[model samples]
Target: MDLPRYPYHQSLEQRSGQPQRRPVVIVGAGPVGLTLALDLAKRDVPVVVIDDSDRIGEGSRAVCWAKRTLEVFDHLGVGEAVAREGVRWQRGRVFHGEREAYAFDLLPEAHHKMPAMVNLQQDQVEARLVRAVQLEPRIELRGRHELIGLEQDADGVTLNVRTPDGLFDMRADWVVGCDGARSPTRTLLGLGFAGQVFEDRFLIADVRLAPGVRPRGLDPATPERWFWFDPPFHRGQSVLLHAQADGLWRIDFQLGRDANVDAERDPERIRARVAAMLGSDGFELVWSSIYQFCCRRAERLRVGSVLLAGDAAHQVSPFGARGANSGVQDADNLGWKLAAVVKGEGDDVLLDSYEFERIEAADDNIGHSTRATDFISPKSALSLRLRKAALDLAAHTDFAKPLVNSGRLSLPTAHVDSPLSTADAEVWTSGPGPGCPAPDAPLDEGGWLSEQFGRGFVLLAFGWPVQAPGLRVITLPAEGVAATRYGARPGSVHLIRPDAVVAARWHRFDAADVAAALARAHGRPQ
Candidate 1:
């Protein structure tokens, strides 16, 4: 599919020969950068996004958008459009050789606003986000503008940008680096990632089956994630198949460390490998790439006045579909806090919480990625045997099924230990606690519970008439899934952050207690 291109234009700062200081200057125009731009714009904070390129990124890089990510997009006003054009699927099948080990459903129940996941190309997502950014008057997107030098002091950062027109200087109270894994901004900051880089490589091919044609034994039209371990066609290696929007299908083949990278990336070689597995050669190749993944993270997400986000902060293997999803979530986590600080409504320490919470999340994602990599590419002979045995048993015994790890799959990690969370003063059962992503439910008021979130601090009061200054007070009925999902009772109250994380809850409403919790959530000293 053809993608829309954006042309580079000289900025006002460059034309006027003046270094204008912006509220927030974001580097990179990928999905994460654009998401942050849109988020800050929504919060009434002006932001400028700079990228070295004029087009959406190349290839179908991250195709899976998780439920939580979709909810975030909903707040940004593109969730429905993305869901409508993307292929939605909940069921995934894991196969051990020729036998099906297990079939799992991501969302077994209904009534949620979004689906389990959506498969859409990265270029398409970026295009939509760019459109949104163009419409927002508060946002300025400068294409072909690249950050070459950055210096941060107590108050703000000075950036030396290189553009097609010429080199220019700009200033920002805050700078965010949303560049990819090999981030130039991170390099300018003299920081590096520290972690494991697996030698094993993988081949990615986007193949489009001929119209009205399907593989002999495989169903290309079915929107399900299929993972194969030691399949007959691709002996000893693993293969992952995912159906994407349009007639395109994404295929990943494990290529061992010693495999020829150049030969494997050849179009004919990719076709042969895909044909061997699909039992057809009539498909057209859209895009192909060979890559070796690593599980690594920066030492710190924030360094003085500059912040690193998305792949610049952390990077994981794509098996779990965690790369882009986690990056978008990082934007969701940082947008509100940064906006508040820029507006002087929040303490500088609140920005520290962004570092703390996102580092915790990155570490969690890195751990999962490391484990999945080790399992998928066992180095030791004993480890290989053990993995094979586990897969073998998983096909027969229910007990061993839990041992199978085809990438744990991306899920939002609760910031239970975050410093921002207000500890529960009362016991709770079967409900989201502090720092947990708020669960969505169909409200009796005809809209979903999540629709009321993302604007600001939300106080859900059940069977109580409570009011707090500057807080959006939502009185929910004490019935249906909204009440049940929250474990609500009469007089129960829950405080949700702008990012839709539960900050604190109370068994009964008390004005003083609510004030204290709100202050704590805002990162004020208790």
Candidate 2:
């Protein structure tokens, strides 16, 4: 589907005048860029987002968005539309040659607001984010505006943007590259990637069928993730199936490395494959693509005033859905820090934490992605045989089922060693450790623990009154989900960062201590 396009505006340089310098210029209008733009704009920071293409994502590239990413979206003002439009699923069933192996549920809790994951087309995500960007007066989203050159000094970064009118120089206090995997920004900075590339190939097909088309194993009304290892129809390879929103189903065929991409993607071959897998051919093929993934990331995410996020900083196998989700979190991580620095509320050292935190996140994601990739594509003869044996054993024994890895799925990452984290002075039952994301808990009257985070420094104290500048406080009961989840005791306080990460927690602390922690989080000397 074609997405609505915005009119291109010429910069002052293109109008035969000196280039206009802005506070922040973001190159790329993908989910990450738009998200960052929205966040910075919401913080009263003027941001200009430039994109090479006017259209949204061509295909349903990243279909599975994780819960943590949704929370970030909720802060950005597009979470409602995303949740309403996406298909929600929590349970997954694995099959070994037509025999059920085991089942796993990522989010079994019913008290939370969001699901374990949501399935929405990438285009749809971009559409909502783009619309939100357009409505923000502080943001200028220039679609079809391409970035041609980038140069940075100690003080600022300048970019050469090519619009329909002409190529013009645009300067900014900082330039962020959310341009994607083949990021021109990263290349221009001479900061490239280094990592492993698995030789396995996968073919993705999105097909639409009637709501009544029910397969034997699948429940037409309820959605679940289904994975098969060496099914009857397919030889030794694996297959993954997911039910998407809009009456669409996604099938991923584990085509071997030597498989012909051209022949396999042909409609007739794809139809035949679908027919054999479904035991009937009654679906319309919507799209098909072949892909091979690399578990890699850039050497560095930040250099001077230019920074890289999302696929630009890293590229991972889609088995875990880490690429886009982590990218969204990267934007979330940088947005508040960048905005604060632009407004002179924080120093550039705060921006340095973006590299520290997100690169750590990128490594964590790459590790998971690589593990899933290796499991999906075993190397040696013994490895292949062992993989099959494990899957076979998984069909019967519960112990063996845990060893099976049909894509480990996406999980939120923890920044265990972030520099901003203040160590806990005393222990508590369920409180998140410093540098960990604050867990969601059910509130007594009506609400959630996550609802209290994401705006500014949040002080969660039980049975005590604490207040500081730009700090929000939440009073928890002596006993409840919030109390237990936070290990909240009387006089306990937990300081949460704007990105919902715990900066510090105390069994007992003073208001001055909280102020110092906040200053440290903002890269100021305490």
Candidate 3:
């Protein structure tokens, strides 16, 4: 059997031309996959993404975008557009009852470049990412195409894809399985997806709120705010309200364990619940559905040439807004490593680091999200009493505020053993650390940390004048704007990776130390 030609143009011209396969073949066109595609494309690595979905749709699922996700978009150059469409949320009010409510402001100082969180529908986010993916010349997006099977060798992977016409085999240096939780690719590898499934089911409805009773502090025209109500439908259920970009409000109601799933599906039952909560608000129904929440993690993220990401790798409860955010982080983490290995800048063993770093991050996210869900869901009688009691205490004490907000919403990475952080340098102590994103700091030139560091490796030197010669370094003044912007001490230097992660930091160290750190990260001593 003659293999297809190696050039994309020739392969397309011959119709059976097997252009030299891309460095990576990504399955699934969701935000995770698209994000990986865009990042790899930006690094000039050829990539092909296959998705069964032909078009993007406006759905009310996974609507919260955290600051870390926003930072990622900023790196991709679509942050402004996302911000334009998204509603900035600085504070959240949690209600124990109608009168005993407590409000916490998420980003009070407003000094950071990105807001703490943004409320935007998941569909809108996908649309933006898809557009970005399409614009990249190195990315070939095959919609309506499905991955039927794939086999991996010591050097590369051969994928079997099914299209409307027939099945075709393509080879690639690497394969990424961003396919959702029930991932066929994962099944093909016989990898186990281990986690728990919550028995409670929740109904999500997207509807237009009547003009008279629009929720306070929410823009009727823009979907920007979230509201959580307790004792929904009865004394035990909970409800969540989210504003959508299309003037529709997304309402999630918890149906007790004994409630009939069929009855909840009825349009009348859904509308009745909406009316009961909003009270004669004349809400017009737009969309309604019910879904069970699951908390699971793949036994392994990488199986030879295949890699799992997004919901395929781990499914977390939605309470802490970790689902999409963590998925995107997985995409970001894997994208650069794939680009490096495929381009021959690094060894294939670098691929193993993706699982090493992201799997732990995913597990951490699951643990945090699970705790948040348990606190909010209150499955047992003791759990319910503890939740109510905690809420009561939070209403009055400042000590409880941090406890409630601790894991509810934050993107903190564990980089202790990551290859990215091989140095014993105390960089993580000053601010951002390796395996973790660099903190957003103001720049002297009226920009943020991202603007100054802009794509690729950056070395911030505080005092010494030694240079890597070939590496990019931005010098900071000893006591001026750069110092204020980066919170740089008099003799410290911060080394940032291509993806804007702090690879290492030195506080008044020898030039040899900086060279050693860079050598470890780039595989060559400066």
Of the candidates shown, which would achieve the greatest lDDT relative to the real structure? Answer: 1
Task: Please identify model 2 stretches exceeding 4 Å from their true place.
Answer: none
How far does residue 202 in candidate 1 sit from its true spot (Å)? 0.5
Q: Could you give the candidate ranking by TM-score, starting with the highest?
A: 1, 2, 3
CA lDDT, every model vs. true structure: 0.89, 0.85, 0.73
Which 10 residues in a row give candidate 2 its minimum summed lDDT? 1-10
Model 1 Cα lDDT, one tens digit per residue, 63-148: 99999999999999999889988988988889988899888889998899999999998888888898889899999888899888
Tens digits of lDDT, candidate 3, 1-526 = 1111112121241266463566788998888998888888888888888876677644668877888788888778787777777766766666655534467666676457788887777878887887787778888887767788888888688877776666677788788898998898888888898887887888888887666667544555543334454644344666676766656677777776677899899999888888777766587888888888888898999888788999989898777689989999888778777777777776666668788888889888888877776766667899777766676788798777554432377575756677756464453334555556776666666777666553567888776555765578776666664565555787778788765677777777566777777666654434
**C-alpha RMSD of each candidate structure in angstroms:** 1.3, 1.5, 4.8
- The clash count of every prediction, one per candidate, is 0, 0, 6
Please, what is the TM-score per model?
A: 0.98, 0.97, 0.91
Candidate 1 to truth, TM: 0.98
Error of 1 at 379 (Å): 0.8
For residue 409, what is the lDDT in candidate 3? 73
Better of 1 and 2 by TM-score: 1
Model 2 residue 332 distance off true place after TM-score fit, in angstroms: 0.7
Per TM-score, the best of the predicted structures is 1
